[model samples]
Target: MSTSLAAAPAATSRRRAPEPPKRTAAERWKRRGPLLPALLITILLTQLPLLGTLYYSLRSQNLLRPETNGFAGLSNYATVLGDEYFRAAVVNTLVLTASTVVLSMALGIAFAVLLDKKFLGRGVVRTLLITPFLVMPAAAALLWKHAMFNPLFGMLNWLLSVFGVDKIDWVSQFPMPSIVLMLTWQWTPFMMLIVLAGLQSQSTEILEAARVDGAGAWATFRRITLPHLRRFIELAILLGSIFVVQTFDPIFLITQGGPGQATTNLPFLIYQTTFRAFEVGEAAAAGVIVVVGTIVIATFALRVISSLFQEET
Candidate 1:
């Protein structure tokens, strides 16, 4: 019986699958022709501007002093590094991004857990929760500024008044927190959607087995569900950080980077440098730095995602 089994395996191994024929150049071109226009357009839209920015960053160009435009080497970068406002902006950007991502992810996980359970009006509740994310950033900022955070007649102050608390100017007094709150509110729904998808994809059989083994809900979640959701959580953090790091609308609309430079982040600083200060070269250098930082983060996130996928497979 062992000899016959070994012979059968050897026979099967001998009958290997046939290799596919290689296509001619024309055939390959025919297949790829349709995608060429889109590829070209993408290069034109993305790569060209990046190259232009790099070129500008090496120059001493200022819109206000056009005649003085000349090659600056790395002076623009040096200027940006030496500027105290730039350092402050970098710190603010990190703080804002970290705070918003953490808050949003926590709330998202809570909401997703609640939504995952079968309950009446679940659909309606989920829809209402998602409304904040669906609203335009500009509109959301405006709504928070006028309808919620206003010291005089806003809903928050009105609620405070009922408890005999003084009306507080939230944006002016707490610019960073105010911006973080708005961002967290908007981004929580996004994180919830990702986590909810992860939860729904879990195996009912495994959950039932855990329950049968005398594991409680919290134990099952902590041991099984949480581990399963790790990838989803990482993905949510990555995407949330990418978006929140580029936050501009809320700061611009609500505080205009604050009563001072209190709320100025990298993106806002770049805007100020280019349009407000008219320092084209410095702005370009800053823009390049921001792009490089974002790319580094995205690359790391993608590696994590790839490793997770390999583990699952």
Candidate 2:
């Protein structure tokens, strides 16, 4: 009886002792332990500038006179919104964003489609196509502003003169268009590369089967390829729009926001306000507005992307 009781106690004790909780989860987590630190650091570094901008937007702290400081709440925002130059900047930015995105996507998709087909010098063509994206923005801007659009001294005017056309100052007559052209030249390759990646992701078998089913090229593209690349197209548009709206280098180097504020974008306005006019508070306000607008658009774009990813899965 004592032996049976002793055995019973031993068995119960063994059962009560928790099996060393499964080690795999803990081991896997330990392996991934660096992820949190990296994420936190990334977030901190990325958000610090924005946080500072937000802080300064609410206070009137002009560099020239720091003593007349006061918290103006949304007064700075009101001031920026009511400014004529600021309005022009916003309008120009929107125009640039729309035109560039549409043109880039159309041309990019066309270029990608052309490149997708096997042909002579296909590799060379791709290399050439991607070349513009690699050009230094400053150097390219300088070339466009001076070498190409210099009216009497410009290549564009020289070319126009060959056809008996009068020389017109590109900066004065077509400032926004000139900026758009330069930006599109720099940016279209980006859309092309992304769209091509999406194109490559389509299954060869599906395309073959479509061809076997008597589907024409247009039908295949519209019905099969376009549907498949919708996500990528959206991604390209979003990326291009983001860059176009905030484009600084070309505008700075070429237009300097001028010939009567025609091509001045919000970014330039912010630069002019803070740096040139030395209105720190107003610049911060512009910065906050820009950040908000960007965030809103980005959120919508990401939501679409997420939906597409879900559909793809």
Candidate 3:
């Protein structure tokens, strides 16, 4: 009876658990205090610039001659909306943005798929692959325009000469394509990194499950991998579109917003308007529009994508 009672007490003790230690105030503050200050700083930094931009967007103050400036109630906005140049800029910007995003996503996915598999010299290939993205935009543009597409002494022309082909003017003949291709080359690695991250994050068990269901490789990708990567793909597009819309260096360096303003994007247009033409109010208005449009689109896309990830979880 004594042994039985001792064994019963031991079993009861095993069933009970010790209480977790309560956190002290200092410990709690240590964990969350830094985060609160960081969040406050982030909000202030972001909001202050936006508020200043909004203020400038409403005023007609030339940086060179502020004495002649005054408040313009929506006049700048009206002018920006009514101008043909602005309309063309909007279209060009959209096209460039779309082209960059689609091309980058496609090529990034292709390269990621290729790179995901083990291969010889993969390290060298990876380094070579990302070299273009790391090149300074100005240097890249200079090399493309002066050395690769200069019509006469350009490497592209020299290569074409092998087939008895004449040199073609890359910027003049295909202004938008040249800009699109250049930006695409520079930004695809951004997408590639995102896609590869997504691919690596995919659940191996889910893939095995698909394989056990007699799914082919294509079917497995369609049924499992793509679904899981929805969030990452959205991230790629979100970031890619924002940067593409604001592109300036390649267009400015390679084409100078021309062969007759053909390559003039929103950012380039803003620069030309404010710095070259001295239209400060109009340029600020343009900046405001670009910022608002970008924020709205990016926010909506991110929310949708975050919901997708949430649904899976």
Candidate 4:
């Protein structure tokens, strides 16, 4: 009977398809212990605000109307979508983001290429070039607005005067262009830094081989350097667009969305809706839309940039 009982247990164990080995607590912790904490923290920080915003967006809460607040459903989204100002803000946001990112990336690539060569005072020059990006955004905007673009005593007008040209009101006369110029000035350095890193990491042997094959500077750059820099450029554009789309300090400090809402991007629009108009629900709805749009853009951008990691033919 004891033998039969032991055999029965063995048979049952075999028929059970041998349970997978149980991981030790230490092993399980080793696999996911570090990432679990960070993932939980990230979810807690990001999801909490998002949940609160979602709740707010679904309610008819307005600072102006204290007693009328209630469940509003999708009315806030409808209001925001139907508004002309929102539409204009969307367009302006697109233009501002596109222009700044493109110009900054172009100038950054140029500067990075030039700086990649061994030249006198290269360290000092690179440091000086990076100063603009390190400046606080509000301070940079203020510097441009008051010191560079002011029609009365700004340096730009003084320079124009030296050329026998009339002093022009920069912000009022060209609001969008003025904002673009300031943002480009500040962000180009950031893009340059990223591109320069990519340039320096390139294989020296590849460049030498291209030279040995009788490739001229332009040909080598067009075929070899440019291809290598493609991923960096895409990354720069992605990062630049993410930041530029949220431009607010420059608009607030320089143009104040003047010249009839010419410089108000989506972030500025959200600020206006929340504070100026006291429409909390609409602002939250706009925030949700912006988040959605950003996700959509980032999804496509990440896919494109992922191609850079594929084995090159």
Candidate 5:
């Protein structure tokens, strides 16, 4: 009887399924092995160029003076940093970036709030607004240069003549402002899209409550809408700063870093150093500095956004 009972338990145990084995890290990776090829390609495309740039930054790799090409240590960086042009470039970069970001954000918020409300043919209007952003940066800069700002024959001159005013040489007289205006015109649409998303995602209940409580449009905007869009505003400013600070196309196509280097930002300076002055190492170092500064700002912006998200949750 005892033997029969033991045999019954053994048979039941034999019929039962075993638990699945835990996957190791390698096994997990293998299971998702199809992504490996694409990831490797991305790394090759991005990381390889960055590594090459870093290596070149550490060496004296002048195309003009190949004989002087070798490991330069930090000498190239010192030279670039010590130059007066670099300091001026930094100042110009800050001015252009700050102006563009501020003006874009303001215009974007205004447009976003306006479009968020019901309107006739709003979709078509939104598409038209976003057209400038979709245009290529260089092409847009060229358009602004020749079509709008041309001293004698451009639209601005024509408009001034219509108004019985003096024609302004925009690029020659106000190079930085002209560049800022072009960039702001192009990038405002991007900021509007971001802010619009934030506006649309807002709590309808709160807005309706504000309306029911007799809160005016300005009051509601100040109390509820503005608070909600703060993070979006920060995000727009951060992104705009990153792109605007590295502006090259407008400076190149519109001003060519002139009216006496008035529009020469870091990227333009780097280009001037590399191609115009034939100082590859110095340009590489400047490029590294710009990249590092961008990364730092991006990190801070991301952290601020994350904190805002956490607060909401």
Candidate 6:
């Protein structure tokens, strides 16, 4: 019996499938040729500008004083790193990104769960929920600034008056939170769409089996649904953070980076440095930093998405 079992393993090893033959150079080129134009265009549009930014970041350049432009080594980077306002902007960026992502994710999960259920007017509800995301960022910011947060004639102050509470200048008094709220409203729909896809993709049969096995709704969600949605949640948070960190429109429209520098973030700071301060070198350095940070987040997000796809396959 032992001899037969050993022989069986050897036979199985011999019967393993052979690898496919490699493609010829010409065949490979044929497959890749169709993508070359798009690839070249993308490089021209993205990589060239990035290289230009890096080149400028290494030198001292001021738009207002063009004659003083010359190589300054890493002085620009040092200046940006040492600037207190840059540090403050970094903190604001982190806080804004974290707050917006977390609040939107929570609201998204709730909305997704509600919409996932079979209910009357479900389609209409989903459509309405998704409208906020479809609205342009600039338009949405303006809408919130004028129609919602305006102290004199805004909906929020009017609502407060109904309860005899004093009118509050929301954007003036709470610049960061007001920005967070606007971002959350716009991005919650994006999160909801992703989470809703995950929810809908869940195996109903497994859920039914859990129910038959005496699992309650909360128990079923905790044990199975939550685990299944983990990847989706991660994806939503990563993507949301990546986008929210670059928030400029809402801040520009709603508070103009606040009554002070209260709402200034990395992007806004970069804008101020380039346009207002005319410190091109420092702004380029800051832009490079932001790009590097975004690339890191994007890399992790791509990995998570890849793993999710692999699991599905």
What is the C-alpha local distance difference test score of each model? 0.91, 0.87, 0.84, 0.88, 0.88, 0.91
Q: What is the C-alpha lDDT profile of model 6 across 166-280, one tens digit per residue?
A: 8889898888888899899999999999999999999999999999999999999999999999999999999889989989998887787878889999999999899998999
* Candidate 6 off by > 4 Å: 1-20
Worst 10 residues of 2 by lDDT: 9-18
| Pairwise TM-score winner, candidates 3 and 4 | 4
Better of 5 and 6 by TM-score: 6
Candidate 1: Cα lDDT at 8: 50
Top candidate (lDDT): 1
Model 2 segments more than 4 A misplaced: 1-33, 307-313
User: How many residue pairs clash (N, CA or C atoms closer than 3 angstroms) in each of the candidate models, in the order given?
Assistant: 0, 0, 0, 0, 0, 0
lDDT of 5 at 142: 93
Better of 2 and 6 by lDDT: 6
In order, what is each prediction's RMSD in angstroms? Answer: 7.1, 10.2, 9.8, 9.2, 10.2, 6.8
**Top candidate by TM-score:** 6
Candidate 3 off by > 4 Å? 1-46, 64-67, 304-313
Per-residue lDDT of model 1, residues 1-313, tens digit only:
2345446523323344532356677876997899999999999999999999999999999998999999999999999989999999999999999999999999999999999999999999999999999999999999999999999888988998989999899988988998999999999999999999999999999999999999999999999999999989999999789889899999889988877988999999999899998999999999999999999889878876776665554
Angstrom error of the Cα, residue 191, model 6: value is: 0.5
lDDT of 2 by residue, 70-104 (tens): 88898899998998988888899999899888887
Off by over 4 Å in 4: 1-33, 304-313
lDDT of 4 by residue, 115-137 (tens): 99999999999999999999999
How does model 5 score by TM-score? 0.88
- Ranked by TM-score, the better of candidates 1 and 2 is 1
Query: Ranking by TM-score, best first?
Result: 6, 1, 5, 4, 2, 3
